[model samples]
Target: MFFFQGLTMGLAYVAPIGMQNLFVIHSALSHSLRRAIMTAFIVIFFDISLSLSCFYGIGTLLDHVTWLQAVILGVGTLLVLYIAYGMIRDIPAPISLKDQPASLRQTMSKACIVTWMNPQAILDGTMLLGAFRVTLPAAESTPFLTGVLLASGLWFLSLTGFVAAFRHAMTPRILRAINVLCGTVLMLYGLHLGYTFVQFFQI
Candidate 1:
């Protein structure tokens, strides 16, 4: 029962079109199949790590430390906006199987940044997963967390696979359009974060 519950919640949590999802989608649409898969795995690693930290205690620390939250929000807002600007400025060209891919180190660094530096993700994970953790029976914690982690893995793999399967049909125009749309969404999210930060001070 706990496993299923956790699985459902996990799916709901990750299904939103957020920074992590946008990065995965861009990687799938732009990179080779193998590279895309590797990127997905890298994202999954950071994502799971963040979730674990949130569930364990990082969220509690953030919740109690107003200054820490402010710093994260301030920095995250700038980082997100900068990334969005880059995505918009450097819209990827059409698929070229012969194109050289980015290095694994760069990809891993980006994955880490998108997952770890997003204040919204941290707060949401803390409020949702961390709060839920306190409600679980000690014995059921393992299975429930297992289910949540499994959902994350399955979702990213499935998302990457689906995008890769249809990648051949994606034209340069279409790719550009998607990139612009994602960047716009990211920009809006960054503004929202800025607003939240300002509101935090007002309170």
Candidate 2:
């Protein structure tokens, strides 16, 4: 039951369009199948690692440290802005299959940064997962964690396949519009996070 519960929570959280999804879709649309798979795996790695850390009580430590929270918020906002800029200014032409500018190592690094630097991701792991973790029996914890990991991994794989399946139908115009939309949303999200951080300071 715990495993199923965790799986459900993971799917619910991951189904929404977010930075990780955006990158995965972009990779699927612009790169080879192998590269897209690699991106998905990289994202899953970060998701699981973060979840595990939070489950082990790291989230509680973070909550007690205002300066660390502020620093994370600041850095996350900046990274979101940077990613939004890339979305707006650096979108490549729609390609069915093309060589990506960065190698696998660079792609993996960017995936890690994007996954780790997003404040939402951190909060999701530390707060949401941590809360759920507290309610579970120690013996069930492993199953629950495995469920979370599986859910995230499956979602990424499905997302990659979904984007890849439709890659041929995406025209340059459509792709450009998608990029613009993603950038606008990301920029707004960053601004909101920044505002929240400032509000905390004011309080």
Candidate 3:
């Protein structure tokens, strides 16, 4: 019961279209199947690590530390906006299996940045997973967390698989359009973060 509860909650938590999802979608639409899967695995690694950290206690630190929150919000907003700008400026070509993909190291670094540097992700994880951890039975904590981690793996793999399945249909025009839309969404999110950062000072 606890595991299912966690699984449902985890799916709901990660289902939103955020930077992580955007990265995965871009990978799926552009890269070869193997590369896309690799990207998803890399993202899953960071996401699970983040979830573990939040469940253990980092969330509490962020929750209480106003200065740390401010710093993260400030930096994250800039980083997100910069990434969005790059995505818009450099739209990818249509999918090609023969195309050389980005290095694994580069993919790992990007995955780490998107998952770790995201202030909204950290706060949300802390508020949801970290806070909920306190309510779990000591023994059930492991199972609950297992379910959450599994959700991350499943969702990313499923998303990658779904996009890869339709890779052939992704024309250059379609890919460019997707890039623009994702970039616009990211820009909006960055602006929202900036607004939140300012509001933090007002509070």
lDDT of 2 by residue, 101-150 (tens): 46877777778767777777788778888888778888999888888888
Error of 2 at 104 (Å): 3.0
lDDT of 3 by residue, 63-169 (tens): 68879989988888888888788778776765677755678887897788788878889988988997789899999998899899999999999999998899788
Deviating ranges (above 4 Å) for candidate 3: none
Q: What is the C-alpha lDDT of each candidate?
A: 0.88, 0.81, 0.88
- TM-score of predicted structure 1: 0.94
Name every residue pair that clashes in candidate 2: none
After superposition, candidate 2 runs with Cα above 4 Å error: none
In model 2, the Cα lDDT at residue 11 comes to 91
- For model 1, the superposed segments whose C-alpha errors exceed 4 Å read none
Model 1 clash number: 0
Q: Which ten residues in a row have the lowest lDDT in candidate 3?
A: 91-100
Candidate 2 lDDT for residue 129: 83
lDDT of 1 by residue, 123-142 (tens): 88988898889999999998
Q: Model 3: C-alpha RMSD to truth?
A: 1.4
